[model samples]
Structures are given as C-alpha cells and as structure tokens.
Target chain A: MYQFTIKPLFGTEEWELGSTGVNIAFTNSALWMMITTIVVIAFVQMGTKQQMIPGRWQVAVESLTSFIDNLVQSSIGAQGRKYIPYVFTLFIFILFGNLLGLLPLGVLGVHPFTFTSHFTVTGVLAVISFSIVLLVGFWKHGFKFFTLFVPHGTPIFMAPLIAVVEFISFMVRPFSLALRLFVAMMAGHILLEVLASFVVSGGLAGLGFGAIVSLPSMLLMIVICALELLVAGIQAYVFALLTALYINDAENLH
Target chain B: MPQISQLAETFSSQIVWLLVFFAITYFIVGRGMVPRVMDTMDRRSKQIADDISAAHAAREQADKEEEAWRARENENRARAQALISEAKAEAAAKSEKKIAAAQKRLDKKLEEADERIAASRNDALEEIETVATDATQDIVARLAGIKVAKPAAKSAVKESLANG
Candidate 1:
C-alpha cells in the first residue's frame, strides 16, 4: 500500500551544496514541517492586534500561551518562566504536526505526513530538552550535579547501586520521550491506513458482503481518527510537561 | 526494520528543517504574540479595578451628600419647631396679661356695689324708725284723748323698738 511507504516527495533527489556533507532536500517531512510553521506563524499573527476584549482567535492563542505558562510555572517553579518559549514552541509544533496528519488528504490521493511520526524529528526535540536539563544542572551545581543520581536517604552501601540505576534512567529519558511520541503517532496512522485499505479493497471486490464489511471498517476508522485527535493533544501536553519536570529535577536535584 | 534504517537516510534533512521551522516559530510566538497577550490581560484587569474604585468613590460621594442634606433638613425642622414654640409662648403671655387686667377691673366694681348697697340699707332703716315714732304718737293721742310731748314719744318709740 502507498500508505505504508515513506517515499520522498521529490523523488529521492538530494541537493549537495558542498563537500561538507550537508544534504538540502525537499522531503515530505520537510514540507509538512514548513506548513506547520506557516500555520503557527499565521495563527500568532492573527492575534497580534491584542484586544482588551479578545475575539475568538486571540482567545485561542492566549489560552494556549497561559496553559503552557501555568504548566511550566507549576512544574519547574518561577525560575522556569524563561523556558516557556522553548516548551511552548515544542508543544505547538508537535501538537500541530500530529493533528495535521489526521486531515483527510488521502481522499485526494495525497498521504498526509506527520513529522512526529518519525523518530528522528522527535529525537531532535528530546535531545534538545535533555541537553537543556543537563546543561542547566551542571552549570548551576557544577560537578555536584552528579549528586542527582544518588538517593537522598540511602545507606552508603546501597548508594553505588542506586546511583547506577538512576544514571541509566536519566540517560534513557530522551530515548523514551522520543519513542513514546514517535511510536504513538506512527501506530495510529498505520492502523488508520490498514483499516482504510481494507475498506477500499472490500468495496472494490464485491457488491453485497464485501461492501457491508467496508461499512464497519469505515466506522471504526472514524472512531480511531477521533481518538487520534485526543492522543495528539495529550501527547504534546505530556511531552512539554515531562520536559518541565525534568528541568525541575535538574534545578532542584530531587 | 525499514523504519529504523530510514533514520540514517533522512536524519540530516529532517534536522535542518526542524531547526529552521522551530526557530521561526519560537521567535514569532515568543517575541511577538506572548507579550501582546500578557499586555491585553494586564490592561483588562487594570480597567476593571479602576471601574470598581470609581464606582466606590461615586457611591461614597453620594452618601456624604445625602447625609449633609439630611443634617440640613433636621436643622431646619428644629428651627421651625423652635419658632412655633416661641410664637405659642408669646401668645400665651399676651392672653394672660389681658385676663389679669380684666380681673382687676371686676374686683373694683364689686367693691363699689357693696358700699352703695350698705348706704341704701341705712337710709331705709332711718325712714322706718321715723314712721314708727309718728305712728305711736298718733295712736296715743287718738285712743287716750291725751296730748303727748314729741321728745317723750320719740324716746318711748325707740325703747319699744329696741325691746321688740
């Protein structure tokens, strides 16, 4: 099925600028990302008038901003206010990226691409957030930042074991964050694609039994799409919320 | 497996696009939209606070004005009451003087009437005494056929009258 393949929209062509090994290519993922950026920028620009009594668009933007602000403030304390921009950017990008894929572009024979469906994009975001946590930790606490690994009330004998466990847990945070988003998005889309293929194949193959089978499949697809929308929002929120929590741990060492 | 291997092939381009788009969103949202929203919220709250305080001030002013008006009305009422009482007292005093003057004149008239009635009674008694003396004298002359002296008769009459 065409839905199962991740083909480059531009026919696998790479624009090699120089010997520096930087490939500038127009991929589907890049196109979707650019669209996401444009959409976000347009939404922000729509609310630029900033009315005291806000209209619908301004209210939407302000609510999202305040939601993220409160999340950051509650999770990471007042010092986390500075990271709101980064967290907000990550949240909106992932949120729209997930939602954009759910749009009915397959009807037009164009498969929608969600940037978050790939591990590489999410991995980059996770790495950025994880790096911020580590850098802020070490910068604020110096070499004692490693103390974050050891449990506070542990016996000296068990301290070494706990530290190793804690270190491993810390190192796996980025991968887990990346995989959680990537897997959820990819799984939901694939399920939708498979169900859609079944509906199409059944509809084309027969007149009575096959068409009746396609009805339930279509209904199930609808239900799954609705669920995917919720998953999209929740996943974005979870990603930002976890990032804030990690930053809090880094700052507070608990 | 294909998906896993796809990472190496698409990693660079994805990273490039991610960085570019993310930076743009970050700048546009962070630098542009956020501050405007915050400003709108702050301004709205400030406007509400100002409205409430102004309403309170206006209410207080109205209360003070009403209180002052009530005080002035009470003072005016008290002054009117005082004027009414003063007029009542003055009328009472004038009536009392008139009654006193009328009482004094009535007393003088009562004394003059008493003196005149006493004088009249004395005059009537003297006339009756003369008439009785003459009548006694006449009776003695006619019935006894004897001539009596006037002074004697008078003395006899006075003795009889006194004894009776």
Candidate 2:
C-alpha cells in the first residue's frame, strides 16, 4: 500500500550543486514543476497565430491574459500592464502545479506522510517567486524601491529606528512572498493527503459495523478535493497579485 | 527566527527538488514561452484595431452613399416642382393668348356696328332736312295764296345789292 507524505526520498544526503551547497535529490515536486513549465511554453507557442480574432487555443491564452490584465489594473493600476505576462505566467504555472499535484501522479512513487520526508517543493517555488520580486524591484527602481519599507510621514526624530525597520521590511519581502505561496501549497497538500489516508484506513475498518467512519472519510475526501481546487486558484492569484504589486511599487519608484 | 532554526534542524531533506522545479519553470516559461504569448497577443490586438478601423470606414462610406441618394432624391423633387410651376405658367400663357384673341375679335365687331349706325343716322338727317324745307314752302304759298320762286327771290336780292 502507498501512503502520501511531504518528504524527500533522500532525507539524509549532501551534495554540491555548482557552488550553491544544495543537496541533489529528485522529488515529485520537481517533476510537477518541470511539467508545469513545459505546459506553459507549449500552451503559449501553439496558441500563437496571425489571425485578427483568436481561435480556441488563442482564446484560452487570452482568457488568462485578460484576467491578469484586469487583476493588475485593479490592484496596481496601468503600470501593472508591463508586469502582466510575468504575473499571468506565474499564476498559471502555480495553479497547474497545485492542480496536477492533486492527480494520481502528483505525490506518487513515495509513501504518504512519511516521517523521514519534508516538503521542499514549496520552498524552491518560494525562492523563485522571491527572486523575481527582488530582481524586478532592482531592475525597475534601481535602489529607490528600498523606500517601500519606509512608510510616508514618519518622524524625523526616529529616522534611524525607521531605517532599521525599513531594512527589516525590505529583507522580509522574499520571505513573505515565498512563505505565502509555500504555506498554501504545503498546507493544502498535507491536509488533503492526510484525509485521504484516513479514508483508506476507514475503508479497511468498515465491515458493516464501521460504516459511520468510512462514510465520514469518503465525504471528507470529496470536501478536500473541492478545497484543494480553491486553494490552488487562490495561491496562484496571490502569487501573481503580489508580484504585480512589487512591480508597481518599483515602477512608481516608491 | 526560532521556528526557522528548529525547522532547519528538524527536516532539511525536501529542499533539493524545490530548486530543480524552480529552475525548469524559470528557464522554460520565463525565457521562452512568455515572449511568444505576449508577441502574439500584441499582434492580434493591433490586427483587431485595424479591422475595426476598416469596418468604420466601410460604414462611413455606406452612410455617405445614403446621404448622396437622399440629396439626389431631393434635387429631383425640386426639379419636378420647378418644372410643374413652369408648365403651369405656360398653360396660363396659352389660355391667356386664346382669351385675348377672342376679346379683340368681339371688340372689332362692336366697332363695325357703331359705324353702320352713325352712317344711317346721317342719311336720315339729310332726308328730314329736305322734307322740312318742302313742307315749309307749301304752307307759306297756301297761306299767301301765291308761291314765291327761289330763283326770283335770289334775283331780286342780287338786283338790290347791285343797285345799292
């Protein structure tokens, strides 16, 4: 019997990943992300055409394109248009990764909820999103984006203290962006997988006397699946929205 | 900060797959896919705008044609009204010519009748003068019991005048 858990296959390993002291171990999260990127590239490329009006594939791409356009406009204003493509890509990639993870192949090959494993996929995605935020900020504002930490109308007497707070706030940008995405994915996956494991246990337990336990587990799996879909959409939206805001802040030279 | 260290000590195993996944997405979509999609969308939007402009031009041309048709219709109607007025004047002129010709003919006939009446009146006056003279002479001769001859009277008046 296979179990679902958030742990790496090589729990105790060390590796040198081209001067970045990263352990080299493959996980399902890595596989899913690879799939997501390939999907995005192919989806965009194949959808491209020379027609005035969009066909089905192009229309599908436009749907996301317009959604991101509106999202950026409402959240960050017109300056957000420049960031739309990147944000849309981020949103779709995260969404698909989360959704596809819910499928049969997402967390397979490894046992569920094992003690030796930890969810590292969320961390890597977090790093990427954070890196983008940092890079985009720097590219747009140079060093002016640092002023984001210092809220307007602060007292001159507390300048040093305010500066320290600003530094801390600036430093936390990556962490915050990364953590928000990582937490949602990690929590949703864990909760759903745990409930699913219980469903199996309950099914085994039910002979006719344990009907009540199995019934609740079955109902719970359905609920979790529904919630998983919502979480996936929300996480993707949050990631894209935050990235756009970061771009907006930088663009405004705030 | 405490939670971080605790997590670091507890489970550092799942970090490797995260890096691999991030790397793949960043390279594929960020570098390759996004540009293609954006380029296509931009091109499509421009093409749609051009199509919209063309449609607008076509609509404007149709409107202009409709306006021209309306103008021509109005012109034709005006020409018809003017022609109708000219025809009415021509009809009045024709009727006026006939009426004037008939009036002139009637006046000429009336003038001829008046001339004939005047001639008859003069003839009657001459006859009446001759009759009155004969009656007067007859009456005088009867009253005097003798007739005076006009030749003798005239000769007597002339003899008197010569002797004087």
Candidate 3:
C-alpha cells in the first residue's frame, strides 16, 4: 500500500524557457504551497482589523504571534527580534503544510499533499535557515566564526579531534533538521495509509468478519490522527525553535 | 523512490512556491499584522491605566469635598452653640437685674413703715403722762381741803407713778 506517493497532478508537462535550459512546471506540491500561503495570508488579513479587546480570531492570531515572539526572544535573545518574521513564516508554513495533508480531499478525486512530508521541501527550509546562521555568523564575526566549531577548554592533543567532530556536527544541522520533520510527517501519514488500507481491504472481503477485524484498526487510525495533529504543531514549533537557537549560536558564537 | 528519483524535477517548483509564500507572509505578518496587534495591546493597557488613575483622582476629590463639608458643618455647629450660650447668659443677666431692683424697692418700703410706728408710740406715751398729772392734782385738792401747791402735786404724782 504505497498510498503515500506524491505525483505530479498535471501529467508532467514542463514549460521551458527558450535556449535557457530552464524548465518550470506546476506540481501538486506547488499547489498546496500556494494554498498554504493563501490561507496564512488570509488569516493574517482577517486579524488586521484589530481592537483593544480582541475577538476570537484576533486572539488566535495574537497568541500565535506572541508565542513565536517569546520563543525567538528566549532562544535568540534580544538580537533575535529581527528574525521573528522569518521564524514566524517558517513555523506557520510548516504547521499548515502538515495539517493540510490530513484533510480528506480524496473524496473529490484529489490526493491531498503535505509538502513537509517531502524531504526536498524541508531540505530547502533547513538549508535556508542554516545559510542565514552561517551568513550572519561570518558577517558579524568575520574569520572568528570558525571558532564556533572548536569546543572551549579542550586539551591540546584532543583539540583537533574535537574540532573535526564539532565541525561535522555543525555541518549536519541542516540535514538533521530537515530529516527530523520530514520523517515525522512522512511516517505518520504512511502509518495512517497502511492502517486505512487494511480497513478498506478487509471491508471489501466480507461484511461480518471484516467489520469486527477492522474496528480496532479504525480506532487506532483515529488515535494516530490525533497524535499526528499534535506532532504537526510540535514539529513546527521545534523547527522554529531550533532555527532561532542556531541563529543565536551564530550571533553569539556559542 | 519516486520522490528520491524525481527530486530534481520537483525541487525548483517547491522552492519557488516556498519563497513566494514565505516572502508574502513575512511582509504581511511581520510588517502589518504583528505591529497592529501589539499596538492594540499597548493601547488597551494604557486605557486601563488611565481609567484607574482617573478613578483615583475622582476618589481623592470626593474625599476632599467630604472633609470640607464636614469642617463647615462643624464650624456652623460651633457658632450655633456659641450663639445659644450667649443668649442664655444675656437672659440670665436680665433676670438677675430685675430681681435686684425689686429687692431694693421692698427694703425702702419696710424702713418707712418702722419709722411711722415708732413716732406714734412716742406721742401716745406723752399724752398719758399729762393726763395722769392733772388727775393727781384734782384728787389732792378735794380730799385734803388744803390748797396743794402745783409743784407739790406734780411731784407727788410722779412719786406715786414711780411707786406703782
């Protein structure tokens, strides 16, 4: 049951720029990304007409903003204020991307796509965040930014070994960040798909035996869905928090 | 497997969309939404502070007014009490003056009555002495048949009166 597959919705038609060797094609992942963007933008726009006393929608927006604001402040310190917008964007994008997959769009003959389930999507985000850390680290500290890889107060003989290990660990930050989110989302969705297939295949066989057998799997799917919802939010928060921490490391050279 | 094999094909589109959406969200949420929400919160807190201060000022003003009213009431009461005591003292002085004048007039009238009674008593005593002397003189001339001297008769009468 490889129901978790991602396919190009438009049958793989690529638009080429003449003689430029650049092919641009709209994919299902692109569609969800655009939808996520629209939803986020609309949510922000809805909260634009704010009041001294907020309503339900405004309260939601303000709480989320303050939550991220506090996260950035604590993780990245005061200098992290400027990075709030980027961190907030990343959080909301990943959060909505994770949640959008759980919608049952298959009723309309469309397979719902979660962009975050794909490593490429998360990989780009991780690389972007990591690049900012490196760029800001180098920009602020110049050549001293490399000192971040060397642990403090190491023995003279062990310094080289520690430095190499630290450098590798530092470089692996992006891949780890990307894979953590990708695998979490991908695994949950795949598990749901496997359980759902068992229910469907069982139901197709016989009504009496199938219903009894599939009931527990159905309940387990529900439980997994609930857990997925929690994971979606937690992963987004973790991603943003880690990004801020990395930025803090770069800025403060810790 | 398809995701890994077709990574190159899907990579650019995803990145492009991600950039577009993220940039838009950053601009709107960062520049627009966040500031407005923060401003609303700030304004709300400011309004609450102002309300509390205004209430405090009003309470203080009320307390001052109440104190002033109490002080004025106390002053009016004291003035009224003074007026009452002054009126009482004035009435007492007037009654005392009336009683003293009445006593002085009564004492003068009593003295006049005493002097009139003593004068009358003295006149009555003198008359009695003259009458007694004449009676003694007549008795002596009738009984002894000797012409008694007037001075002798008078002296005899005096002696008889003294012995009696």
Candidate 4:
C-alpha cells in the first residue's frame, strides 16, 4: 500500500521554499501554476494574431468569453461585465490545472515523486478567493461587507445570533471553495493512476480476466474523468460566482 | 542537515503543495489571463456591432423600396378612382335617357286609359238620360203627358235649360 501510494520520481522535494507556523511548504504547485499562466498567455496571444473572420479558433475564444459574459450579465446584470476578466481568468486557470494534471507525465509523479495532493496549492487558491472577496468587498463597501454576515430580513431579536453564524459561514467560503476543487481534481487523478497500476500488476492471469474485469473500471474512470471536467468548470464558476456575489453585496451595501 | 535529509514526500506535506498550486492559478488568472479574455470579448462585440449596422443599412434600403412601392400604389388608386368617377358619370347620363324614354311610354299608356274612360262615361250618361226621359213620358202619358225618345228628351232638356 505504501509503495503504491508514494511515487518519488522528481528532485522537487529538497527544494521547498519556506515553512509557515502550522508547517506547510509551497513548491510543486507553484511551478505548475506558473506553467498554467504562461500557457494561458500564449494561447490567447497566438489564437488572435491573424484573427480571421470565421476561423474556428477565434470563434471558440469568442464563444467562451461571451458565454461567461452572458452568464455574468444574466446573473447580476450588464454592470457585471466589469468583473468578466477575473471570472474568465478563474475559469481558464482551473481548466488548465484540471486538464494538465491529467497529462501522462504530470500524473507519473514528477521529480522524486512529489505527491500532487499538496494542500499548499489548495490553500493558495482558497486564499486568493478569500482575498478577492475581501478586496472587492472593502474596495466597494469597506466595513459594509462584514454586514453581509448579519443578513437581511431577519428579526431584531435574532440578529446577533444570526450575525455570528453568518460570520462563521463567510469565513468558511475560501476553505469550501478550495477544498471542493482540489479534492475533486486530486481524487479523480489518484483513482485513475491507481487503476492504471492494477492493469500493470496482475501479469498473465491479469491478462485475460484481469484486463476484462478492469475494463469496467477503466470505462467508469473515463466517465468520471469526463464528469471531472464538468466539475472543474463548475468549481471555477462557483468560486467566481461567490466572488461576484460578494462584490455585488458590497456595491449594493446600504 | 537532519532536517534537509529528512525531506521525503509525506502525506501531510502534499497539502502545502496543493495550496501553492492554487495560489499560482489564482494569481495567473487575476493578473494575466483575465484581461486577454476581456479584450477578445470587446473586439468580438465590436465586430458584431459592425455586422448589425450593415444589416441595418440593407434594411433601410429595403424600406425605401417598400415606401416607393406604397407611393406608386397610392397614385394608382387615385387614378383608378378618377377613371371610375368619369365612367360613373357617363353611366348615369345614359341611364337617365333610358328612364326618360320609359316615362314617355308610361304617359302614353295613361292617356289611352283616360280616353277609354271618357268614352265609357259618355255612353253611360246617354243611357241614363234615355231611361229618365222614357220614365217621364210614361208618367205624363198616364197623367195626360206625351211619350218621348232619348234624342227628343235631350233636346227638350237643352231647350228648357236655355229658356230658364
């Protein structure tokens, strides 16, 4: 179980940057994020160079951009277009992370087998979502953003208790958002890698029946993989939506 | 040295790496990726606007043609109305002539009936006069008066009226 679980192939383990109070290191996830950034930049910059009228690439980019735009508009309003860039970026980043994680080399444990289940990645994402919520909140409403926890339409007597509950709930947003996405992506990858190891382990006896039995598992994994893609998109959408909702609350803070 | 040597991919440490990766993605999106997407969207929208404007121009041209057709239709209707009025006048005149001819025929029939009635009236009066004269002659004969014919009685009546 230990051998199957831990695959140390990459030289990345010795090169962790720093440790915090509770003991968390940020290294591999950082590198991958940088890669995700560079990839996103290259994709957009190149996809629009010639910019043919009816070209497939341009249409695709436009379609995605507009889809998110329309979503924001319908959700909040036309005024929501101001936040389109952040939402769009969130979508693309998660999109690459989930997809690139499924890449063979990425799954194979890079540089002395750095386990990709690093919570540092999760925490970082959570913090950003957290920061954005606060930044946008304070930028627009300052102290008023905190009032969202108290909620509206509540009776005066219940206000204090409800406010405390709302505050806790508000504080949990980053954790829930980051945990949901990271858990989903990481779990799906781990399952796939595990199933792949099974097909390799059970040799000749594994050939006929093992391969046949694993067929259903492989097919199930494929379905899950496809579903994971949707989950990835949705998680990103959820994170952005929450941010927007927070921002809208701030903007409408009275 | 012990701490560095002790570095192995532990279950707990993976959480840290996850956070790091998440942060990178968030930052990349926040800084670089989002702006490019927005620019692409703005450009695409501008293209759509240009398309709509071209369509609007074409629509305007069609509208002008439609207006021209409507004007021509109106002019045709007016001309047709004038022609119809002229025809109606001619028709009315011809109908009046025919009606006058029919009235003349009706007057002639009425005059014929009047003539027939006068002749019948004269005959009835002559008969009545003859009968009255016969009755008076009979009465006079019976009471010392002589009998007279219709013509004689009529002459007597005329003579009496002249003398009176």
Candidate 5:
C-alpha cells in the first residue's frame, strides 16, 4: 500500500545538508508522528483538570500517566522520578504510533502510517533511550559505570572473559530494542498486506477460488488483525519496559 | 522495502518529528499535568490521615470519660453501702437502749408491788389474830367462866398460823 511509501510532501526526497546531509522534507511518516504527538498532548491535557474526584476521561488519562509512573518507580527506584517524562514520552508516543497505524482510516481514503515500523524511527527512540542511560551512568558513577558489565560475585579468573561477553551484550541493547519493535510492527503489516493481496487475487480468479482462498484468508486476516492489535500494545510496552530496565542498570549498576 | 532502500530520504524527517513531538509530550503531559495529579493524591491521603487521627483522639477521650464515670459510680456505691451500715448500727443501738430501759423500769415496779403486797398481807394477819383472840376469850368466858389475855391469844394464833 502507498501508506508505507515515503513520499515527500514538501521538499525533494534527498538529503543535501552541508556535509553529513539531512533530509529536511516533511513526509507521511512525519505527518503521522505529528498527529500522534497532538493526540498524546490532547489526551494528557484532558486529564489535567486537577479535580479532587476525577471523571471518566480524567481516569483514562491518569491511568496511563500512573502506569508509566509506577513502571519507572519500580524499575529505577527513587531516581526514576527524574526520567518519568522521558520514559512516558517514549511509551505513549510509540503506543499511539502503533495503534494509529491500525486505524480503519484507509476506508475513508486516508491511509494511516506506522512510523514506528521504520528502523530509522525505532532506532532513533532506542538511541535516545541508550543515550539517556549512558549520560545518567557517567554523570552519577563516572567510569565506575563500566562495572555494569561484570556481575557482582564473578571470580577474578573469569572476569575478563565474562566482561567481554557482558560488554557485547550490553552494547546490543539499543539494536535489540529497535529491531524488536521495528520487526514486530513491520511483519504484522506485511502479513496483512499479503493476505489482502491474496483476497483480491482470489476474488478475481473465480467464485470457488474466492470461497476457498479469499474466505479463509479473510478470516485469517481478521484473526491476525486482532493479533496485531495485541502486538501493537505489547510491542510498545516491551519497548518502554526494556528502556526502563536499561536505565535501571545505569542508575543502580546492576 | 522502501523502509531500508529509502531510509536516507525519510530518516531525517522521522527523527526530527519524533524529537519535536516527544518534547511536546514531555513538556505538556509530564511537566504540566502529572504534578497536579500527584498533588491531589497527596492532599487526599493527608486529609484521610488527619481524619483518622482525630477519630482516634475522640475515641480515646470517650474511653477516658467512661472510665471516670465508672470510678465515680463505684465511689458513690461504696459511700451508699457505708451509709446504710451506719444507719443500721445507729437504729440497732437506739432500739437496744429503749429495751434496756423498759426492762429496768419493769424490775423496779415488780419490787414496789411485792413490798406493798407484803404490807397488806401483814395487816390482814394482824386483824385475823386480834379477832381470833377476842373470839377465844368470849368463848372461854361463856363456856367455863375463863378469860385469856389478848397478847397471849394473838401469840398463840400467830404461832399456829406460822406452823400451818
């Protein structure tokens, strides 16, 4: 579908900055990102009435806010409060991104884009989370932050080998985080696209073929659609949880 | 896939928008709204704590008052018991004194009456003796012309009465 296609809505689809190059053109991905941002802002704003007794909308917003609040608090301990805005931003942004992609806006001829399905997008988020961890670790513990690689009770003889392996594993955090979300979202969308193509192809073939292939594909697509919805929320949660966990390691050096 | 093949073209826009939007969410939701909600929760918890402490104080006060009332009730009961015993002792002593005085007066009256009765008995005896002597003298004189002295007759009558 053209929904996944990156077409420049403003400038030429080319990077031509001074040296490193930057694609300054606004695209469908940026549009969806903007939309999700607006939605997040509005949702949060709706809950900020500061009423002693909250209404339904306020409850909905407060639940999400407190969900992240609790997540950070549990994962990062007392230091978690400082990073709530960051972790919350990552969580709600990705969550809204994933859900917005699955909207039935295609029926109205306005196909929704899932920016989080892109490696560039997920990688950026992962990098941001990783950067925060690095900054917090260094600022709090200096070079001693490197001790995060070695387990507390490791034997001195096995320290170097264990340290190397731990170092590699530690370095893989951002890539794994980016890849998990990107692949999960991309795969589900791709499967839906393939199934949709099959439905169309089967319908064009014949009535019997449509019954055999299109009907089952349609049913399967429905099931997969439901599965994808679950995956969307799960992927967002996993991303946020992993980010918080990584931050925990930096904060507590464990 | 355009995601990989066209990454160069779209990466910058995506990253830029992500940063921009994430900043917006961070400022609006995290900084603006969350503190207010937390404050409300804190205020509610504080109110509940204050109410609980006040209720505890009131319960404690009620208990103290009840204990005082019980102590007062016990004191009054003891005082009433003492008063009842004292009144009983006083009444018993008054009644005993009245009985003792009545018994003494009865004994005195019995003694006086016994004396009076003895005197009357003696007078009657004298009269009888005199009469007996006179009759004896008259009879003797009439029958054999013999006369007896009054004192001798009386002594003889008294001796006979005493012997009888």
Candidate 6:
C-alpha cells in the first residue's frame, strides 16, 4: 500500500501556483515518467542506425516498428500510415510505464512506481486517442460522421434506436480503454502486496506455518508476477490495437 | 489512499509532466528516429529491386547472344556443306574429261596398228607366190634334162597357181 502512495520528492508536499487556486508537486510519478522518457529516447535513438545490416539493438527497434506497422496496416489499411507515430508513441509509452513499475529495485531501497495504475494517467491517454479519432472523423466526413452511430443496413424505423445504443457504446470506448489498463495494473500490484504480507507474517509464525501458508503464497506470488509481466505487454498491445481500430473507423467509417 | 486523497495535488503535476515527456518522446522516437529507419528499409528494398532487374536484363542479353551465335554457326555450317558438295562435283567432272581424252588417243593408235598389219600381210603373200613359181620351173628343167624358157616357166607357175 505504501508503494502505491505518491509522495513529493522535495520540499513541501505541494507548491501553490502564485495565488491561483491550483496546486502541484514533483512526485515520484513524475520522476519515473521522466526516467521512462529518457529510456525510451535513448533506446529508440540508439537503435536507429540506418545501416543496411542492422545490429541487435537496431533489429529490436525495427521489429517493434514493423510490429506496429503491420498492426496499423491490417487495421486501417494504407491511410493509417499518417497515424503511426502517435499510436506508436502511445504503445511504447504505456509499455515502458507498465514494465518500469515492475522493476525489482526494492533491494536498492528504491520502490518502483507504476504510473499506468492510475485512472488519471490512463484517462488522459485515452482522451488523447479519442480526441484524435473525433478529429479525423469530423475532418474527413464532416456532419456525415454521425452516420457512424447507425448500422450500415439498419431499417429506417429502427435506425434511431440502434443509433442511441451505438452512440452509447461508441462513447464508452475511451472509458473502457482507460479503465481496463488502470484496473489491471492496480489489481496485480494489490494481489502481489497482499501475498507478500502473508509471506512475512507466515514466516514470523513458525516454520510449519510458513510451509503451509508462506510457501504457497510465495509460489503464487511468483506465478502472479510472471503473469503481470505478460499482462504488461498484452495491455500495451491491446491499447495500441484498439487505438488503431478506432482510427480505422474514423478513416474508413465502417 | 494518496491516489484519491492526494489526487488534486498530484494530478496536475502528472498531467503536466506526462504531456511534457510524451511530447519529447514523440518528437525524438516517433518523428525523428522512426523515419530514418523506414527510409533505410525503403532504400534497401529499392536497391534489391534494381539489382533483380539488372540481373534479369543480363540474363536476357546472354540468351540473345547465344541465339545469335547458334544462328551464325548454322549458317556457316550450311555454307561449308555447300562448298564441300561443289568441290566433289567439280572433281568428278574433271576426272571424267581426263578419262574420255585417254580413251580417244588409245582408239587412234589401235586403228593405225591394224592398217600396218594388213599391208605387211599383202607383201608376205606376193613374195611366197614368186618363190613357188621359181621352184616349179627348176624342178621341170632338172627332171627333163632340158633348158626351160624363163617366160614359159613363169607362165606355167602362174597357170598351176591359178588352177590350184
């Protein structure tokens, strides 16, 4: 639970914004974000060698780029090339944020923070993606973009009802997108924290009790940690995949 | 939890920094690094395509050259065959003319030999007739113990030769 807390890195808990009603602080979350940013830039910049024969790092960078390239191509067809940078940024950013949270730096007395576990962060990302979808939709089709809510072959009489349902589902996309990643990251961390407590408490009780409770809990914890790593990558893929799908809709309108 | 309780204080900072860092990452990784990689890939593919087309052109050129060489060889072979047949016919004609000339010369020589043999046979027959006349006259003179006249003896031999 303490690991989930966002504390100030220096000075007071927060700073006043020159008589404005707003307050801000440089928390561990921001520090980790900056770290993630640096890591991402260095990894990508180093990997981009532009050589005819790529080295290992360059291969890794190319593999990831091609993965997203294929994803966008499959989902959005040719026109999707324009949106690759945005979608790629979203994917790598969220992926690094998720993985950096799971780093085993606790032995070094630095508790890793998962910024992606928060609704605000995920919500902002989702909003950004959704805004792009809306912009592309409106920019391309103008008022006809509203037709997206109606099914392709709906009856005239049933169109209104279908449109209402479709509109609601369409509007839920961003919320679902944001909530899925937030809940997944938060829940896995919570489970691991609980099992860790059991390990500590059961170990303190006795060797026999430790075998019965702590051993199993520790085993389960390890399994869950492995599962969390998979989840981190899957969630990142899902985020990018869904963003491409949404962009596909905006571009193709179907 | 500070997540909910400290939301007001932290949310602004998180959003501000997230936007800041995200923009930086987007500019550096997405805009800058990615295009260079894509351009390299594009250039590589273009080079491969050019190489393939050049290879294809070379193969076609080789095929054409082989075909032309074969055609020239066949034409040369046909010309050589014609030359061989012409030389054979010319040799046959030359040999036939030489044989005919040799046969004509041999026939002329054989005719002259036949004329010569006939003349010699005539001369030999005249000499034998004269000797027979002289022998008949001498035999009559010696048996009869009388001198026979020359003209008489010659007339007697002629009469006897005619009678026989």
User: Candidate 3 has which clashing residue pairs, if any?
Assistant: none
**What tens digits encode model 5's per-residue C-alpha lDDT throughout A1-254?**
45578877776645446566676677888888889988988887777787767888878877887888889899989878878777877888899999999998989999899998899889989999999999989999999999988899999999999999999998999999999999999999999999999999999999999999999999999999999999998999999999999999999998
lDDT of 3 by residue, A1-254 (tens): 24345556663554654656454566778788888888888886666666777888888887888898899999888888889888988898899889887787888987778888888889989999999999999999999999887768888898889899999999999999999998999889889988888898878879875778677889999999999999999999999999999999998897
Who is ahead in lDDT, 5 or 6? 6
How is the predicted docking of candidate 3 categorized under the CAPRI scheme?
acceptable
* Worst lDDT 10-window in candidate 3 chain A: A1-10
For model 2, state the Cα shift of residue B38 in Å.
Answer: 2.2
lDDT of 5: 0.87
| DockQ leaderboard ranking | 6, 5, 1, 3, 2, 4
Q: A1-254 in candidate 4: lDDT tens per residue?
A: 22123323354445444553333334344456556666766665544543535366656666766777777676667677777766666666666665655555744565222122334455555676578667877887777777787777889999999999988887887777767765665666667667766655533355686667567667776787777667766766776676666556555653
Model 5 error, position A110 (Å): 0.9
Chain B alone: TM-score in each candidate? 0.60, 0.49, 0.53, 0.55, 0.66, 0.60
Model 3 gets an lDDT of 0.83
Location of the lowest summed lDDT over 10 successive residues in candidate 2 chain B:
B1-10
Which residue pairs show backbone clashes in model 1? none
Record all residue pairs in model 2 with backbone atoms less than 3 Å apart, i.e. clashing. Answer: A3-A111, A3-A112, A4-A112, A4-A113, A5-A112, A5-A113, A7-A117, A7-A118
Per-residue error for B54 in candidate 3, Å, reads 4.9
Tens-place lDDT digits, model 2, residues A1-254: 12333334443356445665554554433444556667666776655563556688877876776777788888778766666655766777777766665665534563223211123444454565567667777887777877766668887787779989877876677667767666666666667667767767877876663466667877887887788788878878887787777666666655
Model 3 misplaced stretches (Cα beyond 4 Å) = A1-4, A10-14, A17-22, A151-159, B49-164
For model 2, state the Cα shift of residue B57 in Å: 3.8
lDDT of 3 by residue, B61-96 (tens): 999999999999999999999999999999999999
Which one wins on lDDT? 6
Name model 2 segments beyond 4 Å from true.
A1-23, A69-86, A105-119, A132-146, A206-211, B1-21, B99-164
Per-residue lDDT for A1-254 in model 1, tens only? 24434556673555655666667576888888889988988887776676878889988888888898899999999888788888888898899989987889878987778888888889999999999999999999999999998978989999999999999999999999999998998889889888988898988888784668788999999999999999999999999999999999888887
TM-score of each: 0.78, 0.68, 0.75, 0.61, 0.75, 0.77
The Cα RMSD of model 1 versus the native structure comes to: 5.4
lDDT of 1 by residue, B1-164 (tens): 33566666767788888888888888887666677766776687799999999999999999999999999999999999999999999999999999999999999999998999999998887787788878877999899977788788888887887898
> Between 3 and 6, whose lDDT is larger?
6
